[model samples]
Target: MKHINREVGSLLTRIIEKREKFLRAGDHKDDLLGLLLKSNLNEVEVNKNSDGGMSMADVIEECKLFYFAGQETTANLLTWTMIVLSMHNEWQERAREEVLQVFGNNKPDYDDLNRF
Candidate 1:
């Protein structure tokens, strides 16, 4: 939680500053970070120092959600996969061999992951 708090806080701070520069110049785009980036990105449209944008408290809570949700989903998947593999080494090795045959120990591509 601490690590998530620090990382998200820093990222959000930088994003907010960048958003300010854009807004001041009347720039707009569909960048995901365009609105969500700034702490006051939306608020600044009418009120420069308004607190109408996502609040620090909300951002902090969101960071907790991201960390918990992301970690739990991925960790559960990996743990279950590893358990299944350990219970069936032969099947696991066959799958591994097929993977090596296709990718040959190199990094995978988006296409390959999509297929998997």
Candidate 2:
């Protein structure tokens, strides 16, 4: 567990570092990390005389929480969807048809997923 935690922490640190670089370069994104960094930057600016903003560790922790939470949510959604589809053949067929129609043997992209 400690090893896994260390690995995840290292990955998050690298991601944060890259995002910070982009932020400093004025190429800001509107994603969660970007927003958090922007907010932290603003807070630091506002409280230049004091330590008022989140540290790099704090940002990494927030990202970790969001990352795990999103994974859990997606897992739960897929599990329940499978269970329901197993119980309802009609709905399952409809869903399969929709997927085929939307994807057509190709990997589904974000925009195509929305249509599905």
Candidate 3:
């Protein structure tokens, strides 16, 4: 258990370091991490828990949780979608057409996500 915790701690450290490096490099993208870092709150301010903000540690843990949960959910979704599509190629083609209509070979944005 201690080894596992140590490994997780190391992973979080690496993630934080990489994010800090990116910030130092001025590679600011408009994402969740960008928004959080832009807030310019210290770990102490975040830990105050007064405005639904999170500490650095909490952000790291949330990122780890989101990564694992999103991975599992996406895998399951693709698996089931493939199984169903194999049984219904027509529906699969229709689905593809609809997606093409919605996205037009471009990346979907937040507004597009809500259309579904």
The TM-score that candidate 1 achieves is: 0.52
Cα displacement (angstroms), candidate 1, residue 116, comes to: 6.8
Cα lDDT for residue 82, model 1?
Answer: 92
Minimal lDDT window, size 10, model 2 = 107-116
Shift of residue 30 alpha carbon in model 3, Å: 2.5
All candidates in order of lDDT, best leading: 2, 3, 1
Tell me the TM-score of each prediction against the true structure.
0.52, 0.85, 0.53
Which 10-residue window in model 3 sums to the lowest lDDT?
36-45
**Candidate 2: where are CA atoms >4 Å away?**
105-116
lDDT of 3 by residue, 1-116 (tens): 88987798688878766876787687766776666664544443566756555656777777778778989999999999999999999999999999998889899988988886
Task: Tell me the tens digit of each residue's lDDT in model 1 across 1-116.
Answer: 88976887788667656665886698865554454544355565667555556665565566557667989999999999999999999989998999999889789989888887
Q: Residue by residue across 1-116, what tens digits does model 2's lDDT show?
A: 99998899999999989988988889999998999998998899899999999998898889989999999999999999999999999999998998888778999888877866
Q: Give residue 88's error in model 2 in angstroms.
A: 1.6
